[model samples]
Target: MTAPPPEQRPDRPRRCFVIGPIGNSYAAHGSPERAAYEHHLEVFEEVISPACEKFGITALRADGIASPGDINEQICRHVIESDLVVADLSGGNPNVMYELGLRHLWGLPVIHIGEDGQLPFDIASVRTIKYQRTRTSLAGTRRRIESALAAGIQDGFELLTPARVLRAIQPGAGPAPERPPARPPGREGGGDLPGLLDDCASVEDGLDGVTGQLAAISGAIETVGTLAERSGAEALDLLQAGAPAIARLAAVSRLADALRAPAGELHALTRDFSARTAALDSGMRTALGLVEAAGPEERDEGNADFLDQLVSLDEEVRAALSRLAALSASAGRMHLLSRHLREPVRDLSGALRQLRSAVTCMGGWAAAARGLLPAAAG
Candidate 1:
């Protein structure tokens, strides 16, 4: 009943991209600089990779991606798209800094680590796991990294990056707080088998409803995006020209209004789903224990259906989240359009924030579920 190592497991592994100086590999063998480069590689293998694998995350460095494409594009994709990133700040490498900046701007979770005492003052405020090259230090460093990753994956990563601080100060920005925690429905312990089935059934039902809701919102956002694409100069010119411009502006406002209700609904549903999944964490851990006791065959057979449903829901949520991100960018363009449009745009932006928070919660839930379920983790 013991689970296999993550790489040997049946599920698709979560990815953690490692970003740090690739050190001059071409440096003359045994040079001091060459030693520094080799040490970075050692950190990846000794500290970072093991920590990530503890959570089924495959650790990949920039040079590790094997796909055929522009290396720059590949690195960018991994930086932006990987489930997690571990940034090594040793020596303050420029390329590493640039990639870290991108991940921060994108507002994804990143764990920073550096050589003890070598970190730059400007980034000192950021929490980073520090380590030395000695065998003893690397073991301690790995434990810290594992603990950080586990917490970030379970509770959701919400670091106050520079971009987030700026957004907080923007004219229409407001905090998007999470919904209050509620007891997870359905799944209790072994005492409540029926309740557990009911809990999962309710989640499955919600997921089904959300599929249609997301499709409808996608259509609305498409219309809103097209209207929002109008250049600021064109909008200004139209306003100067009179009635037609007023009508056009009114039309955009109406579209925004149409989007509001469905977006709000989707946000609420995701928040509720996120809450339920989070509440299930302890229950799922308990279930994992049962799986171990019951053995692989029973675990696989028992979880087959439920695991598939979760994987599907994860995909649906991810697609919608990606679309909402684009819609938010389009909505930002409306700041220049008109006064009437601003309020709706502001409301829409707030809705987007709530959605983003909910999605982040869902992400954490999905990661934990991967530990419980053997099926593709999505």
Candidate 2:
């Protein structure tokens, strides 16, 4: 008989939340700044994304999450929840630093990286991968990150209990939030078979609710990704065009206004999405454990009544899990690309810079014309 697959030690689903710049639109398209930006994107996509896929990990970022919630708060939630964090500190981006700081507070391992010579001194003491954001060099970076992730998995590291960090700080400075109390088996409904079955039934009902929530979250994420995609090519168009090329400032302004972040929608979707995924994960573990444990020590492809009973339930569980995985994969991609959505709105800053430069150039020309006029008058 084919031996039953080993009763595997259950582990947390690995989630790698990435942190980095989404390439500044204001940078000249062919300039080094643009190259670096693209390089960062490539590393996350080609290098990091594939590496995560290899390990069945979910890698996400802060932008364009279809979850309806505040962006900052969503980011904070990921910072708290992610199994591993991969931060690109290129050019000492303040936002990366801030999120990295938040990750540190959890006392979990964070893999820090930056463009060589670009990481700030304050964090220099922390071990970091000083990388050259180029195709040739990214293999090394990917290896380092994957190695760190493998290490994290071995440790089964994820969220931290606040008690450890809380004690180190000033007394009464800040209180850690209380965790919901877990119920004991015998304490609930006198622990009889019928009562236990009722508890199981209630859990089954809750899983149904969580499943519906996940479905809504998936739809919302798809919508947010759609909106973010619309902003990219248009922003690139504006960035590549110069002052003389912009015949109508009003048209550009209108475009920028239209691209104004679908921030609220994204936050709502992600907030619900993230929470539901967590709940679904918990439910999945419980359900799978129950089934596996109910079967013989070495489960077989048998025609027993109990095995027959689980056939439909097993199919249902697998179907729900597949959808959940799909949602996470899509959300991870959306998270990576969503940050770039803001760049179109941010082009207003770039536009102002261009206008200032043009105005200064015109002033210089006017001065020259004035000098010529005085000479002609003389």
Candidate 3:
């Protein structure tokens, strides 16, 4: 099935707050600058504010509030309660920046705007809507801002929710942005079914890669064990047969130490990957809901297709998880092998001490034998 465009999806309308610098002086309204401020306020009240209302949004302006302290708390409360925030950064006002910072901290959906030529440096990364002081420019800005807000609203309020932001940064999960459909017109069935199949294929490939890595690590662990056994047995033989065991013991110790780093790294990677996979699993389920409730017509051509894609994606995710599990098991085995190797090293240490004692005893025996031989010969 073909998925619907994001704008057509069923979601809630937004509640927006207009935040910026407001006039401070009580008698300043008679001045030209205050008149300009009033004009700007009139544009919002007459033009921008009504657009929000027409779109079933509740628009609140930040102007009437008294002090920066009150504005700060109010902005925080509004950000938490409202669906979106429209911030005017025209004056490079410090208070505006502070309020914007609060909105960012809450992970609120913010539409930034500035008077043409008044853009700030710090907000360079974000795209901002620019308007002129004239009526025509303000009208155009209102439309653009409203359109952007509409798109955000359709994506669900969760799109700007703090949890969603946190979820996006989580490892193992694909990005929060919607995934493109699997196939284009190039393949069979107008490219829908083929896309689903492709998704499945991708999952299979990921699983295969994970499995291969697991196998490689497992093989390395086995090799370490075999090497340890061979070296340990040789060292034991040298000790029993009155040959020096230092060389054999040292070789075994060095090999064990060499294996430690890789084993540790694999273990840490396994844990991090597992955490990432869990986050992905949650996100997939959420996406599935989005696809399923996209209306009946969307389900017809895109339903089966979307389901197919989802299933394929799920399978791939599971396969990767399974591979991670296998790797984890292998890590456990490596840990056990490392412990086992340590035992042999400990035994070698004890054997070295015993060998030293024997060497000392032999010296005594040689001295007594030398004395006896000399006396007898004399």
Candidate 4:
């Protein structure tokens, strides 16, 4: 019964996959475990469902899929493809953690919530909305969730999980390529090579955007630094005519404020690129499976051309990664130049982490694709 935010609807329908511990159905009808299962269902229907409804998002849990198909594959697809994921970490369910980890690697939007006392120590730093099962508490929880979802939909979700941190620190290591799922039955015709190529092109365009944003941000910082240097007595007299120290402090504040927008834009752009590369990696892996399934005899010149373009795309990614790293390092030096700027640097930090993940994703896909070309020709 929480009041919804102002009417805001996405251009297209959005899907949210919910992950949590669905208690054992095999337990006795009157058993505690079975009762727990029923409780979770009630939570879903009353709390989660209504929250998603206000935003026009369709929410589904793993067991809610109507189609009769491979449930594991379906869950994986939802984790990778859904516009958002809500992970319930109560009791630190292993399945929920695994799905959450996957969603983190893709660097898409996710919201974490859990029972007040049950969150794991490992993810203790993550911002999770905690709630009790009391009717009053649950209502408050729903309102909190509505606010989080509204911000995510309007502004964008910025998550910094351990997986993302590890990738950012370890530049040479990309996420280990997931084993390609078995090509579904009747998929023998082939994979969408052209679609894969288009995805790569889109990534290229995105990199260009990131590069431009970085340049603009760097210029902004330089201008701020120049203005701050002029905060001495002579310059202060000509400008604000205030104490030199006060003028310098004011200028430092302006520098940090100036960084927020460009840094935010870069973060948003790189986050989108990160998701695209993750999907491209998955698609390329699927394409490899189809190629392998077709036998090398079916390989043709078109396959070779795609592989060549992929190699070029990989080089571009590597170059962009180098540039982003260098710029991030420069930003760090600038932050040191003005010690009060750390707060505003948070967005730049997120942007760097996302860019690193995107580069790693594209690199993994390229490595997998490289093997396919020679194998196909043979």
Task: Please report the candidate that would top TM-score against the real structure.
Answer: 4
Indicate the residue-level lDDT of 199 in model 3: 28
Task: Compute the lDDT for candidate 4.
Answer: 0.64
What are the root-mean-square deviations of the candidates from the true structure over C-alphas?
17.2, 25.2, 24.7, 19.3
Ten contiguous residues with the weakest lDDT in model 4: 1-10
User: Per-residue lDDT of 35-100 in model 3, one digit per residue for the tens?
Assistant: 757866866686668768867877787655455675545665675456567788887665566566
TM-scores for every predicted model: 0.42, 0.39, 0.38, 0.43
Q: Backbone clashes per model, in order? A: 1, 10, 6, 0
Tell me the tens digit of each residue's lDDT in model 4 across 59-157.
999889999897876887887677778888998775577677667655557888899998987688989999898998888888888899988776656
Please list the residue runs of candidate 3 whose C-alpha ends up more than 4 Å from where it truly belongs after superposition. Answer: 1-11, 29-33, 64-72, 156-378
Residue 365 in model 2: lDDT: 27
* Model 4 collision count: 0
Q: Largest lDDT belongs to which candidate?
A: 4
lDDT tens readout by residue for model 2, 284-345: 33333233322242222221222232333334334433443443343344333334334442
Indicate the worst ten consecutive residues by lDDT in candidate 2.
1-10
Off by over 4 Å in 2: 1-10, 25-28, 31-33, 156-378
Off by over 4 Å in 1: 1-13, 169-378
Residue 74 displacement in candidate 1 (angstroms): 1.3
lDDT-better candidate, 1 vs 4:
4
Q: Rate the local accuracy (lDDT) of all candidates.
A: 0.62, 0.50, 0.51, 0.64
Candidate order, TM-score descending: 4, 1, 2, 3
